[model samples]
Target: MAGFIEKKALKKFSPGEIICLEGDAGNSMFIIKSGQVEVYNTVDRREIRLAKLGPGEIFGEMSLIDGRPRSATVRAITDVECVEITRAMFDKILAGSPNWLGVFMNVLVERLRIADKKQRVTDSVEIGKKTVYLISLMLEKEEKTTGIIYKQSWKKLVEDISFLLDIPPSQVSGILSKLIFTPLAESEFNYKDGKTFIVKDWERFLKFTRFCKERYLKNITKGIIEEFEVKSEKEVKFLKFINEILKEQARANDIEMEYMNSKCSEILNEDISKYEKVISELVKSGILKKAVRDDGGKYILVDLELFDIKFQKYVDIELFENILKKFEN
Candidate 1:
């Protein structure tokens, strides 16, 4: 089986490369031939490291046996060579293995499912806090060569997290979206390459991550669902509309305040007064600001750096982009 896999289905990965992602449909398993791989899962925007597999260990067998989505993400910690074994190979191997190997595979799959379920129950806020700490660590490591990291760098960062924490890239992206809106990090989205820089403040950022982790853990242990005030639905809609306007039109800063208010009223099909209140709330939150122009006055959506810490929490990128396109036309 090993010889067959090596001859017909060898695969290679560079250091920091993703092998497979959690939740992805998979039909094959990988047997590590050289180097190392890490497995991890992301829950609630936080990555939980599962295990590190060195030479001769097998992964993706659960998917191959059950025909289910991958339970966790796997990434190469170093340059890795793998012998790929497909479902066809599994069928052939099962026939050859005395009934014992098949029994072991079934037992392993059941144990993995139980573990995955427990990991999934972790609080999202706790996971988010963990993600922030991981990102800060990555930024600290990269600070030597380049202080500024871009969007493309995020792909590499995701791979790094998968390798280090054993989490999937899709979950890393989700965690990143949350982190962007936090005070612990700052991002500018309008750069030429669409790269968002991670503001480095290692000490304070890590402190916050630790604080959040402890607080969330306490709440969960006490069976408390902590509650806090949140924006009204109308206010959320208004902010989203403004975010769309700023994103779709580069000249949003020059648009007159009155014009924006009128457009908001038109788009939302609500009274102008409602928009006025929403705008006032946005201004209070520092998401929007008044600017002086030679002719008169206008409102400008503040730069991404000044974005409210909670703004991205309410943002739906797909919905905002679709609305922005319609508004653009």
Candidate 2:
């Protein structure tokens, strides 16, 4: 069946090309002949994958069946070849077919619709990001009337988010309860107004969302088979030296690159010119962020708390998973 269909007007898409965008007007559906594509949608400014389609798979039929805007976006993962069957073309083909064939097609569309609906039941962390975004908007709205540092009542938060995201109030409250476990939340978030939730620094809470999503999406990204759970003895020693440097120095978060160059000589007890490789890897490992000094030299922006956890504790997948697991309503 697929071989016969491939003879139709075929469309070729290269990798990373968008075949269709979510919520766009889509008049046709795609039947994959070869390569791979991913169906995804953006939520909280992040793309959440819905499905992966390979040869002989179909997508975008929902738009044709219901005549609504496309529900999800599709992008080519590899060099892709697909036959785009328009709604009118499909109707014409089905018109010449047996009555049972149209029924079979309808059955396929209904099942796929249900599967896509299930995909939209996003995880709790995604909801947390959405919640933070909503709070930030509310803070801006209420900033003039509030005192220093914006905060919201738990009751208002639950009510608004439940209405905005169309989620139950209980689920929103569950996510908020776990939000306090985050690092920024530990210091800034406090129980007040008779157990009402309050976030002190609006910006810090915003970064918290990105921090969690960065780690969450890291697991979902494909072709990156490496894990930073364990390190070689040499790498561990280097991280220990950096940690000790941070500990001895009172203002250690902004250690200059030139300082690391000096430390390289001291630690190895030889004139090693610079130690750029491991520190660069630390940035990739999410243990450090790069910053710049006034003199135009680079520095490692160390989150002392996260540094201890990921570097000293040698964080494993299960540890971070447990943190996010708490937010799963």
Candidate 3:
């Protein structure tokens, strides 16, 4: 303890300089002496701001007290000065402290443990959903009648998915491995060929996977729903009108332009001429498709049911099914 107090040094940082990185080992804590620093975690290449520390505030205390890896990165947000407290000094201080200090440390450790667990659950669900969504789109684009599509090696595919989604490869791989027990089980990996394939029943599997993904990402999708609500104020009326007309046209199974125009004029009390561009825009955007029946005539097909990205089902059948697995031999 002779030189512990005198040996303590002031650390300085420039604005935008990294003070510490997430996941690195750290045994020292910093108490801000001047200016400000930002603490953050990177998930999917996005910096999630955790906290900002200014004069007299603390950073890096969790790892120092808990003997764990750093959970987040810290960067100086402004030119800063801090008093560095190493583990040895920390132990020295604690050794001379009152009984309440031990209680305080225990409380801090418990709170940190709970917070860390919540973050992991949230991130795992998000990464799982995104991985399923990407794979579904890839299989859909292949247009194979039997839902068979070959992709690169399992490891390379995981890396590619991580790169595309900006998520960590470990999180992507871990979440996807759980998909093996679900309907997506038909997807098989061939390490020898350095490739994998989606074999069958993918349409049903994807719908279930997508719904599960949406459920887990309710907070994120809430923003999307809000934006859609704003758009609905402008577009919902026209969309409803068009969808109703398409439903009526199903008997004829033909969505000719002239019929839509006549119906629009009759029911909407407006010229169909103005909405022609909207219809064309819908076709161009793949919300509506032009197709031909056995005869020579062409018609437009629209599936307005799935236009909203939100799920319609109220119950999670998957969860119920899993509970039933308890009776398995």
Clash count, one per candidate: 3, 0, 0
User: What TM-score would candidate 2 get against the native?
Assistant: 0.38
**Which ranges of candidate 2 are over 4 A from the true structure?**
1-8, 99-104, 111-115, 122-329
Pick out the ten consecutive residues of candidate 1 with the lowest summed lDDT: 320-329
Across residues 86-187, which tens digit of lDDT does each residue of candidate 2 receive? 888888888898999877877787887787565444455577667766766775676532454555677788889888987678777777777666543422
TM-score of each: 0.36, 0.38, 0.51
User: Over the stretch 1-329, how does candidate 1's per-residue lDDT look in tens digits?
Assistant: 55666689999999989999999998999989899999987766876778999998999988998788998999999999998888887788799878988878878888888876655544444455566567766666663434443223666667777666555676667677656665545565554546454655555455555545554566667542222223577766776676677677763454566777678777877665666776677778676776877776755656565554445544533232232222211
Note the Cα lDDT for every prediction shown: 0.67, 0.70, 0.66
Q: Which ten residues in a row have the lowest lDDT in candidate 2?
A: 222-231
Among all candidates shown, the one with the greatest TM-score: 3
User: Candidate 3 residues 22-92, lDDT tens each?
Assistant: 99998899988899999999966878687998998988888888788998999999999988888988887
Count clashing pairs, candidate 3. Answer: 0
TM-score of 3: 0.51
